[model samples]
Target: MPELPEVEVIRRGLAPGLLGRRILRLVIGEKRLRRESSPEKFQEWLPGRVILDLERRGKYLLFRLEGGVTLLLHLGMTGRLLLGPGPSPPRPHVHLVLELEGGLDLAFQDVRRFGQALVFPPGAEPDPLAQVGREPFSREVTPEWLAQEARARSRTIKNFLMDGRVLAGIGNIYASEILFAARLHPGMPAGRLSPADWGRVLKETRRILNAAIAKGGTTVSDYLNSRGETGLFQLELSVYGREGEPCRRCGRAVARISQGGRSTFFCPRCQKKK
Candidate 1:
């Protein structure tokens, strides 16, 4: 699934191509998604309205429309958004297509069919990103705030970061990367962590996320930009997928463990259990 940086990259890529232009055609090939919102409702509420702007909340893309309506999209595992003009062959899983004012066809292709498309009529839906925990880049998300939150919770550190209720925009891949950057163990109990540990986690979270945004996000498998280009951040990862390989920080072998049913890579020596 596309995480926060990936979603942000999508929003940035789609902004120029989608802004100002009117959505002439609305096509929906699939409707089964996380929410109960239907394709028909999307076409009904959208189309004629101008695309005011593009917004993102957590992992969801919010295409703000005229009259305060928002089109919510979640790119589950294999979802891809392709844009541009000229002759372009459509993918086999092109589920949604929005015809622009000209002759452009902005397509939403998803092979896994786990993505979602929903319409939020004026204030009907809240911004999931804004509703989640303090953004790492936000001024409100200070090291002290992270320490307090960690001190108040008893969940594992990695799980705490991944929980949308505690903090939004962090997925499995990022949680591992962030922990590696902080040299902290994923399975460490949150409340048991020292203030210094919390400070390291918060600082590294911002550093890693900013570096990712600068690199256009990470593309481990199927993630692609609007232009079908892969991201450049994967090369900078320290322990995300280097399982069984040598750790970047230490010479010890990087190990992979199943936590919360997800594969997490970390150096046992570097990130020791407390």
Candidate 2:
């Protein structure tokens, strides 16, 4: 699935083309996504509304439309949002296509069919974003705040960071990179981290996430930008996918371990266990 950085890249790519464009029609696929709005509801609420702005919360994309309606999209694993001239190519799993006024087709293609599309009315809070925590770069996510929330949690530090409810937009890939950058072991307990350790974690988290966004996010299998380009961040990964490979900081080989069913990669010598 696309994380925060990947989704942000998509938002930036699509905003200019989508903004000020009114939806002339919505074409629903025969196959349904994980969650989808009814065809009648889509037709009634979507057409004639102009896209005013595009916003991203966690991994969800919000298309602010005229008249207080918001078009919500979640590009689940193997999903791609592409902007193309005229009608899109006849693809196998194109779930939703928005025919815009200026001869543009906003296509939502999901090979795995795990994506979600919904139309939210004015003043309505999206359920997927309801429990999302603060942005990593936000001022509200200080070391003190992270320590406070982690004080009672016995989960591993990696798991804690990956939890969307605690810190939105981080997934397996970035969690490992952040931990590696902070020089912390993934198996360390969240509650055991000191405030100073939390400080390092927070700092590295922001730095890594920002760098990932600049590189267009990590393409670890099924992630692509709105222009169908693979991410460059994976080329610069420190430890996430370099299992058994030599560590950049230390001479020792990078190690891989499974936690909560997700693979974590780090340098055993550099990221000391406490």
Candidate 3:
């Protein structure tokens, strides 16, 4: 699934092509996405509405449209939103297509069919964004604030970081990298972290996420920018998929462990349990 940086990259890529362009029509696929608005609703609310701006909240993409309606999209695992010239050849699993006024078409393709495309009415609060927690770059996300929130929480630090309700947009991939950079074991209890540990985590989280966004996000699989380009950040990965490879910092074999059923990679010598 596309996380924060991946989704943000898509938003930035699509903004130039989509902003100020009216939706001429909408093409809904025969098969439904896991979460999608009805074709009737889409057709009713979409056409003639111009896209004013694009924003990303957590992992969801928000198309701020004219007249105040918002089009929300969630790229579940294997989902891609591709933009192309008019009437391009059909590809497999293209769930939704937004026909723009400038002969450009924005297509949403998903191999796994687990994505979401929904239209919310004016001033309507979508449920997907309601559950997302604080943005990682927000000013309110200080180390002391995180420690206060984690107080009495017994989940592993890795699991805590992966929780979208606690820290939005971080999935298994970035969680592993952030923990390794902070030199904290994945299995350490969340509540056991000190202010200093959280300070490192916060600093590293911002640095890693900013770096990933700059590189267009990590493309382990099924992630592509709006231009259908693969992200380059995977080449810079230190621990996520380097199991048994020597750690870049300590020269020790990188390690892997399962947390919440997701694989987490780290350098055992660099990341120690407290």
Candidate 4:
């Protein structure tokens, strides 16, 4: 799945092509996308309207429409947004296509078919996008919020970070990276942290997330910018996916462990249990 940074990158990429354009046609090829939010309704609300702007909350993408409605898209996994000339022979899994007034069509393709395209009217919110806890990139998500959520939580730091209810948008890749940078073992309980530890974790989380956004997010698989280009952040990864490799900071072998059924990589010496 595309994380926050990757989703943000796609949002920025689509803004230039989408905003100010009128939709001439709307096509929804896939059915069974989040209940009651179908392609027919999407086309009905979208074809004649203009795209006001685009925004992202956590892993969800929102397109503010002319009718005060919002089009919410969750790129669950293997989903991609592509823009190009019309009728580019529908690639496999090209489930939804929006033909713009300029004869250009925006195609959303998903190989795994796990992604969903939903149409939400004004104040008619969807749960998956609404349940996220915070805007990790905004001032709203402060160190105080992080510290408060960490208090009395016995879950592993990695698991805690992945919980969107506690912290928004820090996914598997960033969780490992943040834990490595904070020098906290991924398996450590969140409540064990002192004020100083919370400070380190919060600071490093922001630092790492910002750096990843700057580098255009990690390209572990199938994630692409608007123009279908792979991201470059994978090359900058220090711990995640480098298991058994030499740690950049400690030279000890990076270890991989399963946390909540997800693979987490960390430097043993640098992020050892405290």
State which candidate has the highest lDDT.
3
Candidate 1 local lDDT, 1-274, one digit each (tens): 6778888888888898888888777767654554436766877888888888987767778888889888877888888888867333656877777877877777888887787777778977754445567566777777677778878877888898998766778998889999988888998888777888888888888887777777788887688888878745564778888888899887899999999899989999999987
lDDT string for model 3 (1-274, tens) is: 6888899988988999999999998888999999999999999989999999999889999999999999999999988999999785699999999999989999999989889999999989788898999999999899998898888477989999998998899998899999999999999998999989999999999999999899888888778889888745563888998999999999999999888889999998899987
C-alpha RMSD for every candidate = 2.1, 1.2, 1.0, 1.7
For residues 56-129, what per-residue lDDT tens digits would candidate 2 score against the true structure? Answer: 98888999999999889999888899888868888889988999998999889999988899998888877778
Error of 3 at 126 (Å): 1.1
Model 2 TM-score, 2 decimals: 0.97
After superposing candidate 4 on the true structure, give the runs of residues whose Cα lies further than 4 Å from its correct spot: 34-36, 231-234
Quick one: ranking by TM-score, best first? 3, 2, 4, 1
Question: What are the clash counts of all predictions, listed in order?
Answer: 1, 0, 0, 0
lDDT of 1: 0.80
TM-score per candidate, in order? 0.91, 0.97, 0.98, 0.94
Residue runs of model 1 more than 4 Å from their true location after superposition: 86-88, 127-131, 231-233
Q: Indicate the residue-level lDDT of 207 in model 2.
A: 88
Once model 4 is optimally superposed onto the true structure by TM-score, how far is the C-alpha of residue 87 displaced, in angstroms? Answer: 2.9
Model 3: per-residue Cα lDDT at residue 215:
84
lDDT of each: 0.80, 0.89, 0.90, 0.81
What is candidate 4's lDDT per residue for 1-274, written digit by digit as tens? 7887788878877898999888788777744543337655776677788888988888888888887888788887888899888865667777788898787788888877788788877777666765887877677766677777878576888898999877777889989988999999999988777788888888898888787777777788678777777745564888888989999997999999999999999987898798
